[model samples]
Target: MEHTQPEQGGLRESKRRDTLQRVAQAGLELFLARGYEATTVDDISAAAGISRRTFFHYFKSKDEVLLAWQTGLVESLRQAVLQEENRQAPLDALCGALLKLAADYDSDATFAIAQLLRSNDQLRAANQVKFLQLEQAAFEALCHLWPQRRRRGRLRMVAMIGLGAFRVGIDEWTEEGGTQPFSQRIGHAFTMLRAELQVASAAAPSQ
Candidate 1:
């Protein structure tokens, strides 16, 4: 359902969301089945059981339909980071937000969406842009958690590197044909990162 989260329209009424996801699901499936360039807007509208007008109401283009699932992620992840139930360290909390997002994803569908995006140059570039937004969102969430005004630079670094680690984890997952849970891949990346840092610190020349 990557699981079909379509906050991209920014209009979160129940029916509106349902329609948006329905269209996105249809479009992504067609894109995977037929071919991104070959699939037209009309095909998606027909597949989703929506009118052409309805399709445009939710998505700007076929590409947008594939990408719409990723919109509104910035704020959602921020709120997830703020949840009271998660009492992890700052970096872990940030990653936790992302883990929560992936928790409900349909793994095969998620892999298909990733494949769809990488199948084209424009989509790949746009995908990179979305990830950049995610990094900024992570940074802001960390700032909210620790607003002492002293760790600004460090928080920014964490946000950047945290997403980097996530990218690494995702890359590894996809490379391995997505056999394992994405959260597991992400967790292992962070664990290995922390372990290496400890070893490096322990071996460092004393100041």
Candidate 2:
């Protein structure tokens, strides 16, 4: 018999990824060309050279196509955060992961896709939900980084602070190329939040 087992498995996985890619590309192109609201699932399926049933196998709906990349991003970010060396602080680890993800979107393909997402209301709503999911994933990863969540003095506060800083950094990076890099902005945001928190703590009246 031919040695078809491993090769067959690899081919199957590659074909699945290719199907998803084609569906995503078709959806994005239609969204950009005819506008997001006007583009239907049928339109994308036809463009991708697949039937509607096959399209559903790759993505649930057209909204999913715009938010597709996010499926793998949370896991990628988690890996990046966990693999940092001893020199990296918690904030540094978080920023490094977030910045790397931002850099992934700096390409021409991603730029056009971003513009489409910015202009489309349906895509915007879906994108917002996907972002919330990512934030929760980040929180879970941070909790894993420092076990004993209940014993930690400010676990939730610290998690929220890191995520907020990363959000601001992303907005700044997208709006302008800026003098500084995205990673630097992420660090600066965290530093500013820490300073403001310290000031507020000091200003509180003691009982």
lDDT of each: 0.81, 0.71
> What would the per-residue lDDT of candidate 2 be over residues 47-152, giving only the tens digit for each residue?
9999999988888788789877566887877776666553545655666667676666445555456556667677678777766766766666666776676834
Q: Would you give me the overall lDDT of model 1?
A: 0.81
Residue ranges of candidate 1 with Cα displaced over 4 Å: 1-18, 49-54, 84-88
* Alpha-carbon shift of residue 16 in model 1 (angstroms): 4.4
- Give the C-alpha miss distance for residue 110 in model 1, angstroms: 1.0
lDDT, model 2: 0.71
TM-score of every model?
Answer: 0.81, 0.75
Worst 10 residues of 2 by lDDT: 151-160
For model 2 the TM-score comes to: 0.75
Alpha carbon deviation, residue 2, candidate 2 (Å): 9.7
Error of 1 at 116 (Å): 1.4
